[model samples]
Target chain A: MNGIHDMGGMHGFGPIVREADEPVFHHEWEGKALALARIALAGGLFNLDEFRHVMERMPPVQYLSISYYERWLEGAIALLAEKGVISADEFTARLTALAEAGS
Target chain B: MTADAHGDADVALRVRALESLLLEKGLVESPAIDEIIDLFENRLGPQNGARVVARAWSDPEFKARLLANATDAIVEMGYEAVQGEDMVVVENTPRVHNLVVCTLCSCFPWATLGLPPVWYKSAPYRSRAASDPRGVLLEFGTAVADEAEVRVWDSNAELRYMVLPERPAGTDAMGEDELLALVTRDSMIGVTRALAP
Candidate 1:
């Protein structure tokens, strides 16, 4: 799928923002997302090609709007649900629980 | 926080939930995840690529091998794994400068170079890197002379690329460690040349 996720050579995204002393991950969840992606691949849930494929399947608007790690998180969720490790209802229920808990 | 920021946080929350679910189902382990994160953050990174570049600078024979067989050469230096399995090192000469971008997705040589910087995965870098390599280089504050050429390599296939930046002119007296100090992650990605010593 030639989706918006393939942003290479497109244009108009603006100048790359350079921050002083940027850490590897801006937020703790970003780190966890990266780790989960790696571990999931390692555990034979999916190959790297599948990982990239899922990210490519993201809706164009959402792909453009989300941050990089957020995209990774989205990919992980899609992979997990597809693999049947977690159901769509379970994912929604968990998100609702997390929302109500205000975490 | 902005709505985008809040949405990002919510995504993170979902990730945490998924992680817990996986752990509970015995599909994955916490220690394994911790180890993977530690490998990326500490053990692997552009510093490893810097070392490879520095070694190539100091040894002509090693440079030949690196340019010829980047994956094996990189593994000789103890950096080899999934994403980096197919690696290619392009050299920067006075006449030609090299730039790398993955048009399909952010397919980087992560085993050696670690996680890519945010900008490398940004829409601007991806879009501009191939369409206007020179302009992108200018944004990176790297001036490619009018007489020179800019070659953009799209890591769109299984193969990934890293730039073996031209050694700075005044660095004849510098040791490998000193030279390594000047090889920024951007240089390897070909957004810029190696910094002058």
Candidate 2:
């Protein structure tokens, strides 16, 4: 359930719950997570400087849960797509995965 | 109900209330507070238990008894509930180290090991420690030997454990009290071990 820690970002994984035939986020907490993540990305609230603090002050669980990490991911993706940091196809795939995880 | 800011009355009042409530529900023949009161009256805090552990550190035969069956040995030493609860002690060895966690809330070996520490209750530690004992211990600053394989004990109704750490090296001549100083409460519950003093 907390397997997100092992990540270069795992694909097809964003659901909070794991059932035999269904991989889905817990309906209640996920929607909130996505909204928060989107806001952080669009607002430029997370940056490289803030990230070092994440590593220093937060344990693994808190590090990932912080609003800034998801926001940073979203911003990085947007910038990368605009500036050719990665191809558009790769960006779309990554964004879709992030959106799923943010669920 | 809101409790008094001072914790002193909190335990006492709660104990009284629980006894009365249990009695009303017919869970027991009597609402006797003395049963729990007796538990508190005995069972020295971690400091005293550590002293006993230190004695065992120096004494091979005693350590053997502790590893063999901790409950019997502890009762033989005159520590028990007025109505005692059974306790089982598990030893932490060189090849196979043990770490204990009350995954189902805070079921501890209170007879020998007294209480759980703060980190023990955190959802983060409990959820991760069982699956990742090595990582958690490293975070706790316990370095295990490369050859040592860690075993995490998830405590429940049927099985509970207390760790009997291997006596630290280089303290062969120390007296009982000095050895006990090395026996940390956390080590008994197996999150950490007593360090050599």
Candidate 3:
């Protein structure tokens, strides 16, 4: 089953902002992925009653996504915007193009 | 075979020591062009693990022995668990079913079962496995009785588990060699049951 952490279009977020590409690695648990997986597990295991309750506590997709992906073109731009990598106006314009393409 | 950086002491020692040792020689002078092989004595890789499942699937008497004392029964076949104890091999009878999880960290029978899949180590799997096993199995495309009490095993220092999936229907006459081919890794993990068709 898809774990709560399996995102619809969120893999390969980035290693761009990383200043150091050090050989020695420190393992960090992917929190956003874990959370998404937990929500999906709730979908699989819990009854509707419990599922709704758990969903209330889970984060919205917008917050969990990192930046750009092969999917979620808009969220990627928003991440760049939040970092001041792009202006809000630029973010909207790119997102508008993305929305029109899907149509 | 790549473990995350925060792996336990065993992984750290084995991986780091071997890599550095290889580099100390001229074999990998750059250390960047890595081509190191990891080996172990009596490695009970998947082939051995599959044999255990195949034997259990075909022999009722062996299954009984496996259930009564899994570690001892397994040792007779030459696969010995190093870190697990109180091993319980749960038979997947048609009337009842079984699955496994580590509510704590991934406490697995590394000797007999080999490495755990990525999903097995995640928090969602660990948390929901015991309480909502049926739905989890269903999501993974395994059959279950809504009426069947979905037994979820929580592995510990005391109790480690291996799911003996119900030998799937329509393969009674199939020989051991043929049957082993049908036993997917997921079948052993309890996400699905073994089948020949």
Q: Per-residue error at A55 for model 1, in Å?
A: 1.5
Q: What are the models' TM-scores?
A: 0.93, 0.53, 0.54
What DockQ, on C-alphas, does every prediction get?
A: 0.61, 0.01, 0.02
Ranked by lDDT, the better of candidates 2 and 3 is 3
Q: Say which candidate scores most in DockQ.
A: 1
Candidate 1 lDDT over residue span B1-197, tens digit each: 11243466676677778887888889888888888778877887899999999999999999999999998899898887655369999999999999989866677888668878877777877878888888888888999999998899988546889999999999999999999999988899988888888
Worst 10 residues of 2 chain B by lDDT: B1-10
Q: Mind giving the per-residue lDDT tens digits that candidate 2 earns over B55-115?
A: 5677789878877877777766665622244566677777878887764344566555554
**Candidate closer to the true structure by DockQ (higher is better), 2 or 3:** 3
How would you order the candidates by TM-score, starting with the best?
A: 1, 3, 2
**Candidate 2, residue B110: lDDT:** 57
Candidate 3 backbone collisions, by pair:
A3-A37, A4-A36, A4-A37, A4-A38, A5-A33, A5-A36, A5-A37, A67-A76, A68-A76
lDDT on C-alpha atoms for all candidate structures = 0.82, 0.52, 0.53
Clashes of each: 5, 3, 9
- Please write out the lDDT profile of model 3 over residues B10-47, one tens digit for every residue: 33233233223324433233322221111111243455
Residues A9-102 of candidate 1: C-alpha lDDT, one tens digit per residue: 5768888776655678888888888888878887788888888888788777777778888777778788778888788789788778877888
Docking model 3 quality class: incorrect
- Minimum summed lDDT over a 10-residue window in model 2 chain A is located at A15-24
lDDT by residue for model 3 (A8-86), tens: 2233432212122221112211222222222323334223333323332234353232211111122222333444544
Off by over 4 Å in 2: A1-103, B1-42, B81-84
